[model samples]
Target: MEVYSEKQQIRAAIDALKSKNLTLGLVPTMGALHDGHLQLVKKALANNDKVVVSVFVNPTQFDNNEDLVKYPRTLEKDIALLKTVSRNDILVYTPTIEDIYEGNTVSENFDFDGLEFEMEGKFRHGHFDGVGTIVKRFFEIVKPHQAYFGEKDFQQLAIIKKLVEKHDIPITIVGCKIHREANGLAMSSRNTRLKPEYKKAAPFIFKTLKTAKELFGTKSANKIIEWVEKQFANHDLLELEYIIIADTETLKPVKRKSNQKSYRAFIAVYADDIRLIDNIALN
Candidate 1:
């Protein structure tokens, strides 16, 4: 249940834990806790001798001023949720802007040219760079043997995996399952901002993804896209952003599959300006 706000304290804490030969696990978060985030913590707890959950709201990831201004911040409630799970949990230090980025001499930014321009990245300019920069910093500070991320952010998970591999950081990255509500909408902090009616309809995203899965191999990529598009068009509140049926791993839009049987259907939409994203695997 210990909370720290200084780098020196973080170093000392990790150093002390390392002295005891503990296998450390790091769960990086942005301060608002939900079932999805807790699943990550639970995984880290199971996999390591000690688990550290960081509650820093990284400033660099937001693409809009309004989004940043409106992003939820419930540090006390978040901390309480973590503490209730376990008092022995390691909470990482959260540095202020002055502490994190001191001057023009901050660590070099990730290139992220290819990674940043796909999926959510294409929509949010410099978003992956912000994700990459802070993730790199978090790993550098925590130095955990392993890290856990949610599948809800599948693309971000993919980018972070590539980041670790490219940098040769000695850590295992694990992607946990996406947590969902009874109605099937993926749990996210942003879900809080949705209007009451739109909140109820949010589960339709997952349902549409389910529909994509059911219709996957029966038709060509274009056919699948058309069918999904029509389904989305039926919902007046859900405005389709993009519906892409692409390669399972590469994420490139698939025109024709030669031997690639596996596919992923990624979609984005706005329900009264609250952007929602989701993807499903189909083979």
Candidate 2:
């Protein structure tokens, strides 16, 4: 597998493959490699002639400086993990901060319709703008036929879809299923920071979501939200941040279930300083 740090060289390498009429798939990631990320790579490899997996931890995406500093970086381990995925030369792009941000590192402002004003956006100001900026940059740099993203970041996935639609970017955005641990906790790079006991309690987040899903049609959305709030309220280790039952398309919180629209239960929890988010479809 050929690993590259420079954008120009990476683009040249991709262009070489494209010259032979090879189809390309791109999987953009912040490094701390795990099975969840590899699943994305596996999906990309299955679909395209070649794949480019980027492992740059984007600074613009983090609203909290501490979270940014504390965020794990395992480039060597990441490369080793990528190697285990396939014998095929997966083009691994690990750009430096200077490569991605150049001199001005400020995030570009984007209007994600009203989608930016809810959930993660409300909590992390300018977060989606960073996401939109970096993602758009990757689209420009990689120029792949199709790009893969996991559905774990459901809101981000929606924003990206909106981005592609609004800009008319010529690429298919494939949302893969959320990868989870045996305990049902959603996989995240931040999972690395969880303390031992917090890690043990982490699976409760998914369990609560599952229970909430079961209560969906029987109870009102607001009632279910109350119940979930209570569940996390009583938990010693995990603290609930926000929970919303929203229409899948618009992401506006719904008071009651509608047969006409699909809905999902989205939740954010904090195990001390480490934040974890998870969602489940409640159709």
Maximum-TM-score candidate: 2
lDDT for model 2 comes to 0.93
Q: Give each model a TM-score.
A: 0.94, 0.99
lDDT of 2 by residue, 1-283 (tens): 8999999999999999999999999999999989999999999999999999999888899999999999999999999999999757599999988998898898998988989888898899899999999999999999999999999999999999999999999999999999999999999999988999999999999999999999986899999999999998898888999999999999999965678999999999999899999999998
Count clashing pairs, candidate 2.
0
Which stretches of model 1 miss by more than 4 angstroms? 103-108, 258-261
Best by lDDT: 2
lDDT of 1: 0.82
Tens-place lDDT per residue, model 1, 28-54, is: 988778988888888899889888888
Error of 2 at 166 (Å): 0.7
